[model samples]
Target: MGASSSIPTDPNQRVQVIAAGYGRTGTVSTALALERLLKGPVLHGGSQLLVRDDKYCKLWLDAYKAKDAGDKKKTLKLVKEATAGFVATADVPPVDFIPELMELYPEAKVVLVRRDPEKWWKSVVALTSKATPWWLDVAMAPIPGWRYIPAFMRRFSKSFLGLAGVSDDKASPAELIERGGPFLLVAHNRRVRSVVPKRQLLEMELREGWKPLCQFLGVRVPKDPFPRANDAKAVDEHAARIFTRVLQVWVGIFSTTAVVVYTGWWLWRNKQQSLIRAWKSLKTMDVRKAFGNVWKSIRLIDLRKSFGRVWNFFKPANIKKSLGAVPKAVWPESKKPVVEHSTGYSSIWLE
Candidate 1:
């Protein structure tokens, strides 16, 4: 027999029900039913790791490692921490830790939800038909919680399959579901029966519904019909919503990134071409001559100032008056008109 439960019998145990069944066996519907009957929250599959606090992932991961290491005390402690607040549990990672949970909460009742093995396998295949696309991985890689999905899957799978001593190092949880055959169902049910005491255990199918469940838990049959949550159609719809959301986010991100990168590249290329053209034009010029021209332009400012003063003093009219006053012998030359150029310079021509 597995080590006996060490927990002191608590009249007010936090967890009242534990569903130690593989998923796709009406686990979702069972969870919903239990919530209504027990009047408390049930930790179902997706919420176990997907939606709840990210810290739960670490807690569960630690517990898994502890369990693998054969540290029962530590494993029990971490499992309790991981599953603290919920009144009942169902499906996947939570169901995977049945032995630990039974030990920790001896008062909690175990309900094994079963389906025909062939039908269960078919349901699993339909649910996990689409493997995560490569682009989806690339897109979700930057998301902190999402990036750890693969690692989490591997670890969780190893621990879960370990329960049956079923060695599967090659296949993923999805692949395992597809190829695992009927033996998986058989082995899991056998193990649960072997471990849990008959008095504390209740095995029920989806078809059996409220009658057995209510009688086992000593709760009144709810006026409402037993929940039929997460059927194949509902699973497909949920998958569609997730796919659409992921596709939309990645599309927007990829489109914006492509536009920004192209714009930056275009600007850089044009600027580079301009610089290259400038450099080539400079290479064709005489450096000394270019420097001399620039220097001359600087010197021209001072020369223009001096010339302005001289021009004001020696106006054309003043020059003509001075020439008339001078004798013909002194003037002895042909005179030409003063030409003013557009560049603010005046030329006096004499022949």
Candidate 2:
């Protein structure tokens, strides 16, 4: 998705470009570039469908359902309504609906960004992760509004990959990518070529630069270079930022809850008759005295033991087990062991 400030606020804005390319094919860069050229935000699927508005996922879900039920009119209408205010649509679920989108917006120019099949598959493998990690859900659970993202990703993954005839509900995005991803990429580009008329379609690559794209769209090229975004390093940095924020929120919640529970227990243990009096007494207490009381109540030995337990939970062996570092139970006893995870963290610790 484009930055919040870049997204159009007006629901009346109509889509002028339809990106029929699969994701990790410069769709994010295309969305950013289109924002500059078209002077309005473009909808990038996957993250956009869940991150921006809470209702978008539901709308797209309904649209997918309508399409599955052979209700083309309803599907088009839902997609139209869902994408209102965007100047263009790009990436996954939207890529899957190119035919319907072309039917919905006849004037919208389609841009199919192509990548080398082998390179695209490698990128996809590197970029994708499990649909949702257990830690992510646990961290986001307290924030009711943000809790919908994981669920949306899971649903969207199944539906989007279904276009490639992948119906494995339990498979991770990485797993799905390992299974015929190169074929899917080639077939999808071929399908786009067939579905879109030559007059309406502009097939180019990320390395081709802005000239072709600008000429095709009939828009003047910007003075600045084209946007470069969603690359592997950028993606890693973005994920790191999100994880940092989640960790901060989780720590704040845990600390606040612990303090509140301790305070309540202190009040109950003291046999305080009136809640009002207890609060007044707490408020009037000396800062040093209060700190001392809280410290004494917490019991240093117990706190230290709790920290030790947490440390042990995140120990190398435990972390590995939590992340599925061990081989599968289904593997035959005769077969050599296979470790499917990345080795990036190996430099930091040994297991």
Candidate 3:
């Protein structure tokens, strides 16, 4: 199908632009561009829409039937109405659902941001160990959240379909990125060229900032430079955070279990195995934290403020809403339950 074919006849009709590049494809830059150039609100990986905006997600979930791993537009009519109504929200980068997006938003504008393949490949390769939570590390498996386990398996299938030049499954510190990169870049190129004007999808780098992107998207340039790709070595920093959070959770749970058993006294020794198992479970990402980056990356949320959302979910205080017994935030002076968790996940590492 063609670009005009999927979109409404009105040239001015609101367009849903899916920046379909996998991770490290200048998605952040693209988000900044769309916000500045199109006078559009960048959903930042659809985080705001998917998590914060209850109505948007509900309609999206209901419309698309919220398939975990398959067609994204099962509810196309619902999508068009919901998305158009809240033009403020952006679609998540459903990497696998590109075809559906193309068909669903025929008039959708697609931007394929890519860099030199060899360079991109190297960057992706470097990121193999840098983006995943360390709990997944063989050495770290003693801890749980890092593993993402089978329950979270569908998640990996959803937002991130291995972007390196390799398979997406069980990526080693090295080979994990070999299968997904080039193919993803190629797929994106084909999709955008087939739909939006090739000219519309410029090779705009984040370092160069808003001017080139703004002009292409028909918006005025911003006074400030757009955020660059890989600032502070983002992938590495992210991976570190994953590892750190995993460590915190793992240690937190084991320590909690130990103290509880000792203080309660008379705990059976055989129960130690169960406690250890529970500790491992806690070591996994604090429910909110586990999906935090995924949500941010999928929806491109500016995470500066998302910690509160994550913390709320992880460190819920409200008894009315909690499951797994409300977590008590372990602070230097006190452990206290402080928030409500509505995110449909939980972990022992949380206070």
For model 2, what is the C-alpha lDDT against the true structure? 0.74
* RMSD vs true structure, all candidates: 13.1, 35.7, 34.2
* Cα shift from native, residue 55, model 3 (Å): 13
Q: 1-351, model 1: which lDDT tens digit per residue?
A: 011112223324488899887767777787778778887677775444544445666777777678767899999998887667678888767777888888888989999988898887676565555434445556555544445555565665565466557766544666565446656777788888988999999998878879998999998888888887756655566557556766787788889999999999999999999999999999999999989999999887888889888897699987786566532222435644333323234443334
Looking at model 2, how many pairs of residues clash? 0
Model 2: residue 68 alpha-carbon error in angstroms? 4.1
Q: Over 4 Å off in model 2, which ranges? A: 1-5, 46-51, 68-71, 130-132, 169-171, 271-351
Kindly provide the TM-score of model 2 when superposed on the true structure, using C-alpha atoms. Answer: 0.68
Superposition TM-score, candidate 1 onto the true structure = 0.72
- lDDT for each candidate structure: 0.70, 0.74, 0.50
Predicted structure with the largest lDDT when compared to the true one: 2
Backbone collision tally, model 1: 0
Runs with alpha carbons beyond 4 Å of true place in candidate 1: 1-13, 131-136, 155-164, 173-179, 292-351
Question: What is the per-residue lDDT of model 2 for residues 1-351, given as tens digits with 9 covering 90 to 100?
Answer: 322224558988888999887877877788778888898877877546435555666677778778878998899899888778888888766887888888878889999898888888787666556335656667766654356556655555565466578776565544565564677787788788888889999999988889999999998878898888755655566567567877888899989999999999988967666776878988887979878988888775687889899999999998977787443333347665444344445422112
Judging by TM-score against the true structure, name the best candidate: 1
Model 3 vs truth, CA RMSD: 34.2
